[model samples]
Target: MKAAWYGENGGPEVLHYGDIPDPEVGPKTVLVRVEWISIEGGDLLNRIHAAPSSDHHIPGYQAAGIVEAVGNEVTRFKAGDRVVAFDWNGSHAEFFAVPEHYAYPVPEGMDLRQASIVPIAFGTAHDALFEYGGLKAGEFVLVQGAAGGVGLSAVQLAARAGAQVIGTASGEARLDRIRPLGLEHGIDYRNEDIAARCREITGGKGVDLVLDLAGGKGKDLLVKALRPHGRYSVIGAAEGTLPSFDFFELIRKAMQVTGISFGRDMHTPRVHQLLEDLFADVASGALVLPIEREFRLSEVREAHEFVATQHPFGRVVMRP
Candidate 1:
């Protein structure tokens, strides 16, 4: 099968697209003919930081495709079923072989392109907001880097759940785009002070929850924006600079910081039910995950580079 892989960690330029051995499907595995692969933030982070398990390591996590083969033990699906699959790697290829537990059946009427982007982004946001963050209706929630995939998902979910959603984007144009999706307040992080705006928006009471997707220098501002004992959901670090909370800082506010890893729960009944509902929402036009850009598998380097530098609104997809 054709794949984009690398022998070592580096930038998008390190990726090489060519022929690679087809993954062998095991007893509990499902082989999917890849249609769309979502370029997640973890993909870039893994390319630059995570060690490769093999000499030729394919990097990606989420993809939607048709099931070409199913394992002997697999009872949920069979050949000709459309599904979205997730794994720590091997999604950047023509055929993705994953355990049946990691595969979610796409809704009957949804496009493969849209189903490909759902699980990770929506699951991560759902867990961060409700499962870990303990968000309540009428509370104020601030989503940093709100224009990205997970960020947009958080804004929409929080807003729909009745939380006052304050989102941070690079500019007015991007912020304007998501307002209809349920952003109650927009903060142009480039030109506005997030903490100040949050304080003002909440009438001197800081936000009840802060979803920090951009984990660089902006972290302090998010910390300041949170009210005492507020929940801080650490989901991703788009800027690549992770911040550590000091002992004094934690004590001063009695804040709760939770790190979200959606993959950990992908096989659980809770997440399975969550994805089922999410898939239905997208298929029925109740929820939306926009495709900011699309590329072919051969342009792997350019696609990864565009995701890192272009500040894509939702997700960047690749066809194989």
Candidate 2:
């Protein structure tokens, strides 16, 4: 098999695509012939040795593929079954293995490339908004960095749930792209003030929920923009510094500030049900995965470079 492997932690240039030994399936694992794999920030982290993984690791976490074979204990899936999987690595190659519980059947007529991108960004957004934030319909929701992969997913999901979304981007073009997503307001952080604009959009009541990805001074800004007793969830820091905020402000408003890490614990049975619901939405044409670009498996370095640039309006995938 041809796999992209990194012998040491470094830039995308370290990614090597060549022949490698085939993976051995475990008793609870299913071997998949990967059709598409999604690249994520976590993969970059692992490549740079920032994540707690082995040195020469297969970095991809989400993939859409067909089952080639199943281990002895795998009963739910059979050979030739199409599925999308998450919270596992080794999808950068043509073949990979995962636990049966981690894989879900892809909905009929859904594109495999699009399905590959769902596990990380969409799954995280779904868990953060509904499960953790308890986001209700008709509430004012603020999403910072609303043009990135996870951010865009949150925007669409919140809008689909009948929430009034206020998306914050850095430029007019990105802001323009966010406007048609049923957002009530679009804040260009490069020109407009995010916290003040959020306040104005909510008629001085402030946003009911804030999905903040760009941590920095924005953390403090979100604290000011949130309504009393509002909920705020932070998943990433793509912007400036992450400084300590005023603890008194959170105490005064009785705000709930939580940090979310989309790990195996979050991918519980209940969470898988949410993913299935999302898949249903996709199948019904109510939800869409807006892919900005696609790369081949051999171009793993270039794919990582593209994501690092942060210019894509949607997800990026590697078609194996």
Candidate 3:
């Protein structure tokens, strides 16, 4: 099968597209003939920082396609079923094999391109806001990097749940695009002070919760934007610099810091149910996720570079 892989971690230039051996289907595997691949933040992070587990390591988190085959042990899915699949890696290929549990049925009539991007971006945002952050209606929740996939997802979910949403993006145009999705206020991170803006927006009490999607130097500002004992959900680092909290920083603010890794709980019955609902919501147009661009699998290098440098509003997808 034709696929993209990198021997070592670095930039998009490190990625090479060629034919590699098809993955072996295990007893519990669901083999998908990949149609669309979502370029997740973790996919880029892993390529840049995580060491390859193999010389032919193919990196990606999610994809949607027809089930070409399924293991004998797989009972829920059969050949020709449509599914959106998740795994630690290997989505950037012609065929993606995942455990049956890692696959979610795409709603009938939903586009594969749209289904490909739903689970990770929406599930991660949902978990960060309510399940872990304890966000309540009427509370002020600040979303950092609101233009990205998870950021946009958080905006809609929080807004629909009755929370006031404050989001940070790079420009007025981008922020304008996000406002109708239930953003109560928009901060231009490139031009405005996030901490000061949050204070102003929340009447100096700061936000009740902070969703840190872009992790980097801006983290300190997000920390400051939180109210005392506020919840902080650490989600992603689009800036490519991993941020850390010192002991004093944590102690002084009395903040509750929770690191959200949606993948850790994705295989559970709880998450499967959550994803099923989310997929339906998306299919019904009750939820929205925009795809900024699409590329062929052979153009993986250019796709990765565009996502890293262009700050795509929602997601970038690839076709096999």
Best-fitting candidate, measured by TM-score?
3
- Show where candidate 2 strays beyond 4 Å: 7-10, 45-49, 240-246, 265-267
Model 3 lDDT tens row, 145-231: 899999999999999999999999999999999999999899999989999999999899999999998899999999999999889
Better of 1 and 3 by lDDT: 3
Higher-lDDT candidate of 1 and 2: 1
* Number of the top lDDT candidate: 3
Using all chains and alpha carbons, the TM-scores for the candidates as numbered come to 0.98, 0.91, 0.99
Query: Which pairs of residues collide in model 2?
Result: none
lDDT of candidate 1 over 3-114, digit per residue (tens): 9999898888899999999999899999999999999989988898889988899999999999999889999999999999999999999999999999999988788999
TM-score of 1: 0.98
Which RMSD values do the candidates have, in order? Answer: 0.9, 2.3, 0.7
Clash-forming residue pairs, model 3: none
Candidate 3's C-alpha runs over 4 A off are none
Over 48-162, each residue of candidate 2 has an lDDT whose tens digit, in order, gives 6555355556777788999999999998899999998765568788888888888888988888887887767878888778878899999999998888878888888999899
lDDT of each: 0.93, 0.81, 0.95
Question: TM-score of predicted model 2?
Answer: 0.91
TM-score of 3: 0.99
